[model samples]
Target chain A: MSIKFKHVSYVYAPATPFEQKGLDDVSFELKENQFIALIGHTGSGKSTLMQHFNALLQPSSGEIALAGHRITPTTKQRDLKTLRQQVSLVFQFPEAQLFESTVLADIAFGPKNFGYTDAEAKKLALKWLEKVGLPKSIANKSPFELSGGQMRRVAIAGVMAYEPAILCLDEPAAGLDPKGRHMMLELFKAYQARGHTVILVTHNMDDVADYADDVLVMEHGRLLRHTTPSEVFKDRAWLLKHGLGQPAASEFAAQLAENGLPLLPQPLTLTALTHRLVAHFKGGE
Target chain B: MTKIIIGRYIPGSALIYKFDARGKLLVTFLFVFAIFLANNWPTYLVATLYTGLAIMGTGLRAHVFWDGVKPMVLLILFTSALQLFFSTGGTVYFHWWGLWLTSTGIVNAIFIFLRFTLIILISTVMTVTTQPLAISDAMEWLLTPLKWVGVPVAQLALVMSIALRFVPTLFDETLKIMNAQKARGADFNSGGLIKRSKAIAPLIIPLFISSLEIAVDLATAMEARGYQGTSGRTRYRVLSWQKYDLLNAGAFVVLLILLKVLG
Candidate 1:
C-alpha cells in the first residue's frame, strides 16, 4: 500500500522530566516508487520519522498506513515483523550492525528472517553481494575482515537482499569517500527506479538535487515543507534562514545571477546549469 | 536511551549533592553496614527513617529512587520467597507441599528485604547525587593509603573512570544494534530460551565488536594525548571536604547509633 502519516507525534520518555518531543504532528503521504529525501538539521525528527516507516518507533498519537499495514501507538511489535520485512530501514553507520561470521551469511540474514527458503535466501544474498559491487570471493570471509567500505556495502546489501517494497536509509553514505558515496547513492536510485520506494535521510543538498524526486523538509519536529528539490532551493532566502545549503549548481546559478547573467529559470543540477550557461551565451550571440 | 537507572547520576544541587563525593561514598558505606544492624522491627523502622531522610535530602523525586529499585524487584521478591520457604525454626505458621513458612523465616525474610532495600536506596542516593567521575576520584583518594602497598591507584582510577564513561556509550550502541536487528526481523522477545539466545547473537556480536573498536580508539586517543599512567598529572577536579560534608557524616553516625540502640 502507498504510505501515509496522519498527525503522527512521538514523545520520548512521555510524561517524565526527561520527556522530549521527537516528532510534532507530522503528517504526510508518499507516492510509490519515488525517491524521497528527508532533509532537516540534527534533532529535527528526520530519523524519528524514518523509524515510523516500518513501525519501529510507534507514533505517540496518530496512525501510519505503511505498505498496507496500519501502525498506531498500540501496534504490537510481533504483528510488525511482516511490515518490517516489507519496509526496511538501514540506520546510520549500518556497518556497526554487522554481526555474522561471513559476508554472505550476514547478507542472507534478512532474507532468511523474512521466511525465504535457505536456497532462496542464499540466491538473494549472492545477487545483492554482486549488485553492491563486492567481489564474490569475499563471501566466505568474515565481515569484520573486510575494509570499512566493504563492510558498509555488506551491511547495506544484507538489508536490500530481502527486496523490501520501501527502503529507508539514514545517511547510508555518511562516512564513505566521494566515489563510494556516489556508487551507494546510485544503488538506491536504481532500486527506486526498479519500483521500490526509497526514503533517504541526508545532509547533502547535492545528493538531493541529483537523486530525489520529492523533498521533505523538517524543522522543530514538524514537516515544514514537502516539495520538489527545485522548489526546496528555489527560495534561497528561506533556505538561508533555515540554515540549509543550495546544491552546487544552484549556488553557482545564484552567483551567476549576481554577476549580471540572470537566467530565467535557475538550474538545480550541474547539467542543467551547464545547459543554462550555454543557452544564455548562445542566446546573447 | 535504555533507562538503566542503577548508578545513574541525575543533575541536582541538593544537600547531598553539596556534600563531597568522598563523604557521600563513605557515608553510604557506613549506612550499608548500619542497615545490617537492623535485626528487629524497631531497628528496621529506624533504618527506614534514616534512609527516608537521606532520600528527602537529595531533592530528587521519590520516583527516581523507585525507578532505580524497580528492575531488581523480582529478584528481591524471589530472595524473600526463598527465605520464607526455607530456614525451619520458631513457630511453623504454614506448611504446604514441602514448603514451610516459620515465624523465624518470616522475620528473617522481612529483615533481609529491609536490608536489601535500605542498602540499595542508600547506594542509589550516593550514585544519583555524585558524578561517576567524582566517584572514581573519591575512590582513588580514599585508597590513597594503598599506594604505600604498591597498588597502581591512579591507573586504577583512570580505568574505573573510563569504564564508567562508556556505560552510556555502550548502552546506546546496544539499543542501536537491537533496533537495527529488529528492522531485519530479529525477534528478541516472544521465543523459547534457545530462540531468544539465537536472537541475542546478532545483538551481542555487533555490540562486542563495536565496544572493542571503541576501546581501541580510546586507547589510541589517550596515547596520542600523552596520558602516561597519570604521572605528573594534577587533578582537573580535586576532591576536597565541602561545608555540608561534616553534617552529612554526622547524620550518618547518628543513624548508626540510632539503629544500634533500637536493635
Candidate 2:
C-alpha cells in the first residue's frame, strides 16, 4: 500500500505541563512497491511516522492517507482496523512481543485477529514459519524457549501471516549478528519479490544502500531529505552535515573519486565496487 | 496515560533538597493536620496565608500546582452544593423543593470549600517538592522503629523505589506492545467491551512476559554486582540532619501547638 503524510504534527501531553512536540509538520509520500528506508536518531519521530502508515496513530493536526483511505481524527474506527490489516508493522526487538506459548500460536495471532478460523490461522502460521526458514516441528514449541533469532523470526512470521499489502519494520536487524542480518535481508527480498511494499526504519546505512530503492532521512522530528538512494549518497557533504554518512562502499568510492579516479559509479555495495574495479582494469587494454 | 498530577514530583535541586526526607514527611503531616484543625474564618485565613507563603518558598510553578489541584474541583463543588442545601442555621434565604437555603448554609459551603482547598494545596506542595525516592527513604527511616515488630520495611521500600524508577520504562514498553498488536489488526479501541478487553489481553500477555524476562535479567545483574540488600550496606550518599531540618522540626512543633490553641 502507498502511504502519504500531509503536514502532520503530533504533540505529547497536550494541554499539560509536560507537553512535548514529537513530530513537526512532517510530509512525505511513498509510492506503491517502493522499498523506502527511513533513518533517524532517537526520538526523531521515525517511529511516530511508521505508526501513521497504518492509522495506528491519527495525526494530531494534519492528515495521513493509506492507498485511498484518508486517516483523520474523524476516520471511522472500523476503517482503521481494516487499514491496520493492510499495513503490518514489525517493531524493534520483536521477540519481546511474543506472548503465545507456542511459536505456532504466536504467528497465528494476526490471522486470528483478522477473523480467520482456527484451522486457517494455524495453516497460515505454518506457511509463514517455513517462509522464515523455521521447520514445522518447531511450531509446537514454546516461543520463550527459542533462541533470540528464532523468536524474532516467529514474531515476523506472525505479522507476515496476515499477507499485508505493506509491511513496515522498525530496526528489524538490531541485535542480530551478521548472518542473521543477511537472512533477514533475504527474507525481505523474497517478500518484495511477492510484490508487497516494504518500509524499513533503521539507523544502519549499509542496509539502506543495499536494499532501499528510496530513502528518507529525519533529524530532530523533521524530515531532512527524501530521494533515491543513489541521489542521497551523491550529496555526501549534506549527509555529513546531518551526522549521517554514505554506505562504506560509497565512502570508499568517494575517496577514490577525490584522488581523481573516475572509476566508482556511485557504488552501494562492496560486490558492485569490486565489479567496477575489475571492469576498469579490463578496459585499460 | 498521565495520572494525578499532584502525585508527580518535578525533580529539581532546590532548597527543599537539603531537608532530610523524614523531617519533610513529619513537617508535611503536621502542616496538613494544622490546616484541618483550623476553626473559623480568622483561623482559615491564617492557615491560608501560611500555606501560600510555604508554597511560594518551595519555588514550585503556580500553574503546575493548580493543574494538580484541578481534579479536586468537582469534589469541592459537590461539597459546597451539599452544605448549601443541608445546613439549618442563620437567617433563611430561600427554599425550593423542600430544601431550605440559609445564610449559614452559604457561609458553611464557602468555609468547607476553602478549608478543603487549603488541605489539598498543602498536600500538593509537599508532594511536588519531595521526590518519590526521598519520600520512600523518609518512610523507611520513620518506620525503622517498627523493626522491633520484624517488619521488612527496607525491602518494601526498595521494591517501591525500583517500581517507581521503572514506571517510565514500562510505559514505553507498553506503548511498543500496543503498536505491535495494533499493526496486526488487533482492534483495541473500536469494539464492544468484551472485544476491546480481549484485544488488550494479548497486549498484556506480551507485556507481562517481557517484564518477567526483564526481571530475570535484573536479578541476575544485581546478584552479579554483589547486591545483598540494605543490611550491612553503606550508601554512597547518605542523608544527614542539617540545621534546616532541625529548624523545620521546631517550626512544625510550634505550628501544631498554635493549631491546637486556635481549635
Strongest candidate by TM-score: 1
Q: Summarize candidate 2's per-residue lDDT along A40-82 as a digit string, tens digits.
A: 7777778877877887777788888775689876776676767
lDDT of 2 by residue, B1-263 (tens): 22223357865666766677778787777676667777777777777777787677677678867976799999999999999999988998898886879998988898888878877787777687787877888887888988879898878878877787777778888988887877786767776888877778878998898788788998899889999777877755467889888766766666666667776
Summarize candidate 1's per-residue lDDT along A1-285 as a digit string, tens digits: 578999999998786556888899999998999999999888788888898898879999999997889999898888988899889999999999999889989999999999999899999999999999999999999999999999999999999999999999999999899999999999999999999999999999999999999999998899999999988999999998886889999999898889987876889889999999899889889
Q: Which stretches of candidate 2 lie over 4 Å from their true place?
A: A73-78, A235-237, A254-262, B1-6, B11-21, B35-37, B55-117, B147-152, B190-193, B236-254, B260-263
- Would you estimate the TM-scores of all the predictions? 0.89, 0.86
RMSD per model, one decimal: 3.6, 4.0
Can you write out model 1's per-residue Cα lDDT over B1-263, one digit (the tens) per residue?
A: 32443358888877778888889888887776677787889889888988899899889999989987998899889999899898799999888988999999999889888888888998999888988889889999889999999999999998998898788789889988999999998889987998888889999999999999999999999889988787789877887787777898788888788878888
Two-chain DockQ for model 1: 0.54
Clashes of 2: 0
